[model samples]
Target: MISACGRDNVGSKNTAQASHSSADAATRTIQTVKGKVQIPAHPKRILTDYYAGELLSVGGHVIGAAPLEFTNPFLKDKLKGAVDVGDPINVEKALALKPDLIVTDSDKNYDQLCKIAPTLYIPYGTAHNIDETVHLFSRIVGQTKPGERLLAEYREKAAAGRKALKGVVAPGATAGLYEITDKGDLWVFGPNWGRGGQAIYNALKFKLPPKLAASNKQYLQLSLEALPQYAADYMFLTSYDPEHKGTALKNLRQSPVWKDLPAVKEHRVFYNDFNTFYPYDPISITKQIDLFVDMLKQNAKENKPGQGQGR
Candidate 1:
């Protein structure tokens, strides 16, 4: 009887040891843009200085964020309860949140955030390809399957957008995308910039004018004098400041150079809202594709081929 009791006790001890070992293996060491970070098996309270849109797209939990007014406008309502840590992020406020993990693209506040928690700094423009951003976010949160599913969904939507605009826009048709600041600065974007370039140039395969196509920079700041050189068959124009009340657009319309542009003369310019069309994340991309297809259809109906000077 004594021997049997000793055997039972040994079996229980081994089982408990095995369980503890499994739990330890669950936690992993991951390599981030900044360096290596050991994260919990499941992080509940996550703080993101930026890339909130990308996190939300993949269904990651974001308990805290900074610059909420700017990056998360599309899903602001959903993040109503999230703690706004301030633009540049307040270290005191962030620590008070007691986050499990903190993610950011800026290194300015990296040391401060690291002291508060296990912070991961993802370099700026690392995810210019959108798919890379989604995959990276998924791997960080241990949601690889969901990330793949979300990417598939985005691909399907992009394909559908191309099909929808097939009859509306002819092959080889060129387009120019530009944004004007309240201070009267003109900005043009390239294929990887946030201004619907992925959807316009990559997905829909629109051509850029020769002058604008020369450089590979995400965006170029140009003067009013140079605007005529970037003219194309169609134009997508927007203003950054919502309260500026069309002052920039008004000024551009007054310019003789702008009026003489082929897109303007043919009335093929589509004025877009900054908030809806500027972001390059999964959510914004979906909306941009739909809006772009509709705009092309409308332009095709109103203006036929050879109606514009360039055509």
Candidate 2:
């Protein structure tokens, strides 16, 4: 009996060793924005400190995320059980989750997250366009095929939007977007920002005036008095604080400078929800395109003689 027990114990030890070897062999080294990391063949539990939308777009199995509330509303219902790891990321909570891989923005806590798990640093605004950002994240998580499909779908939607808007928007027409903060500061969004700039200026092929076209910055602070100089044939206005009761919009509508602008006189200024238009990811861009096309069609019917004719 003693000899038989010893042989059984030896066999169990060899089996354990073989299982560990298999696990080690399943991992492969992949280069990240920060450096190379050995990740599992399929990362089942992923912790994305930022760009949760982009990760989900490529079908990443995200277990935890940061800035959880900022995820696009369309995907919010899908992330019902995702843990909120805090904006800068709560390392202790992240460690408790025991994720197979962690993806974070290039924030100050990059090194700290690396200590907790196999982390990859992908900074926000690093990619120039949504497709580039999606592709990069997909490659990191070994979902390149899904990423390509997502990109193709996005392109199809954009092309359809352009076709729909062509008949509604007049030739040589321009569009502008601005947001008023709760503190009453005015800001403008460009092609790089999350405020529908990519969909409006790039995908939909809208024109930007010479003054607003001079810079490549994502956002620019503006004064209310100078609103006329940057006015376009159509304008989108929304408040930074969604629950503010439209105080800023009210003030702008009452102002002589704002009332005199062509878009305002023509009733071409459209109001949008802060949450819907704030994210510039693939999902959000798709929604923004839909909203833009719908609004343009409605506004075109309201266009009157001598409306949107001013400089």
Candidate 3:
């Protein structure tokens, strides 16, 4: 009968090296939403439940993240080896990656995640805006310098965009962002939420309807029949099945209430996929500014005043 081999001689060098690496690995302590915790000085494999895009912009080595981060086209190329661990995050899948650090926006399974690696808890709406979020993530990854550079670049682009779009788009033009879920739920995004709201309202300086702006809320749920009550100059309707002939879109169109809106009547509405501009991360925001400028410019050129999408 064979006996189990011991660690006396088999791959001794590798074992020694691994022990040395563990013992010599540098660490740093920082205050997190869950209190202070020490982590690797430079994390190599990070799995996050949300805001994965913020870390990616600062040259983070993300190994796994949630499904939303993987779906954004702007971030897809940067996430080469990353997989979606799950929205709430599957601890088993997270452990399989052997992540050096884990960041999550929820407290569910916090203890379980800590067993796999040094975990940092960051709740949703922790930062007031995307710029603050970039600063937050950069500090978390010890990438503050690069984060500063990215913010400067984003601001510079917005400045140039503001000048280029001068007198092109209608002044005081309000753009309303809406979403139709697979379940036919209608949502209006506030300034802080993603789905291109930050790009359109903050970076581009567009206005929301007076009522939506006054409410100061994250999202406003509205029935299809109530849509006409808060119409704007332009509308961006993001849906789960943007390209396909989805039931939500069909149902919305069938309602005479939708057809009577001024923005709809003038064809100043765009139907976009949910993932198209879902990520409001700094990197995505930078790219989105360029897309918004072009889209608004094209809308102005294509439609005559009070004719097509936007006057």
How do the residues 123-156 of candidate 2 rate in per-residue lDDT, one tens digit apiece?
Answer: 6676778777776677656667877887888788
lDDT of each: 0.72, 0.72, 0.76
Cα displacement (angstroms), candidate 3, residue 256, comes to 1.6
Question: Which candidate achieves the best TM-score against the true structure?
Answer: 3
**TM-score, each model?**
0.84, 0.84, 0.86
Model 1 lDDT tens row, 1-311: 11111112121110001111243676545555444465655667888876677777777788878764355457687567788888677888888998887777677777777777777667667766767777767766766676778678778878998888887788899988899998789998876777788778877889987787887567889899998888778889878875767787788878898887877777788888787777777666656777788878877776765563221
* Clash count, one per candidate: 0, 0, 1
Superior candidate under TM-score, 1 versus 3: 3
- Rate residue 215 of model 3 by lDDT: 82
lDDT per residue for candidate 3 within 103-210, as digits (tens), equals 788889887888888777776677767687776777667666778888888899888888778988777889898888878999888777888887888888889987
Off by over 4 Å in 2: 1-25, 28-33, 68-71, 242-245, 304-311
Q: What is the lDDT of residue 92 in candidate 3?
A: 91
Candidate 3 achieves a global lDDT of 0.76
